[model samples]
Target: MLNVFTPNRHANNVLEIKPEELKERNIKGIITDLDNTLVAWDEPDAPEEIIEWFRKMGEAGIEIVIASNNNENRVKLFSEPLDKSFIHSARKPLALAFQKARKGMGLKKEEIIVVGDQLLTDVLGGNLAGYYTVLVTPIVETDGFWTRINRKIENLIKKRLKRKGKI
Candidate 1:
């Protein structure tokens, strides 16, 4: 099962990749997971570090759109303050959510990158959607049990990838 998947290309959890870097990869847009990927699970606003990252990516001309499974209230609460574009009720790992986010960004699956912290949801969802995936370590350590289980599985795959020098 692990052999059937592809983890993100970047090593760091910060996912501080700039627009130029994305452009080189031919990535015109981004579909990101909001909670643990960009902020702590319940953080209300973007931190300074996050704001800078957003500004940098924006200056690079990359459009940012969030694809999260969070509810409308949670999603809007997280996004409206940052004034960023995003989709709530993403239902990730399901290609439909990723597709919706991509469409909203005015980009195609091939040209968009999905950035998130989880393997089963974010990476799998992005892979299923046929977009390039970037996995980052979670910003906080508050994930649920099910998510924790998936991480363990992901770690095993990562270890194998490392042994083969594929990560």
Candidate 2:
């Protein structure tokens, strides 16, 4: 049960996940969370560094799909400008959205990585779907009301994982 919340890898931020390392691991596709994972939840656009990171991944022949539980308009607004694929209102930890994104990528299960800032949605969802998971630190300390609740729960889980040396 606790294993579902554990990420295969952790990074301080998305930028710390370099294209070179992914390429080395033969990672061809990424299904990543939109808000907080890529940028602040309330932030409207991608910053320059993030844009460059996307460009670098594209140049490395990696496909990216933005998967968010946020509304379609919000996800569409963010993804279209970057010319990336996306799945909105993902209902994650459910496997369907992750599978849809993987199918769209036309990649094998082992070739994709799932990344986000949350354990409940991202890590558990990715693990349940059998993808390599990367849990990046949330871009901001503050979260929306619901996320704050999730974070409190995550803290308890983290403590247990820490005690077991599984984090």
Candidate 3:
């Protein structure tokens, strides 16, 4: 139902999600989307701010794993330099990739949070997998070809959710 697409929390961007708040919530790990969720879809790498965010999370002893639908090369390239774990070609909106990321983190479902920009992929997938989900606004308003299609559908869903005041 619509609840599956609704996030438990929302933030303007990933940087707005503070480590202190997460720690207070007892969330020890993050399963995050890569492209527009963390940076522009076309961005080749993480920018300084994103890097610093990762550093903060690390300093707080919070583990992070990137789960991206993009190819291995793209995900690996972005993740390796950050020295973070990743799952590529993740096929989001499916539970398998989320499960893989959770298992890799070795964190219980209650100890993890899923962060992403898209509801169809990120929120739905995370909710279905029984994890707390945070929907951060995409770093850029623009999206890649396939994501644009999802965005259109997401807009419609958002409107409905708004009418119901569930978002």
Per-structure clash totals for the candidates = 1, 0, 0
Each prediction's TM-score versus the true structure: 0.86, 0.97, 0.97
Candidate 2 Cα outliers beyond 4 Å, as residue runs: none
Tell me the lDDT of model 2 at 27: 95
Candidate 2 or 1, higher TM-score = 2
Cα lDDT of model 1 by residue, 87-140, tens digit: 888778888888777778788777888888887788888887787888887888
Enumerate residue pairs that collide in model 3.
Answer: none
In model 2, pairs of residues that clash are none
TM-score of decoy 2: 0.97
lDDT of 2 by residue, 89-157 (tens): 999878999999999999998999999999999999999999999999999999978789989999999
Local accuracy by lDDT, each model: 0.79, 0.93, 0.94
Q: Report the lDDT tens digits of candidate 3 across residue range 23-57.
A: 99999999999999888988888999999999999
Arranged by lDDT with the best first, the candidates are 3, 2, 1
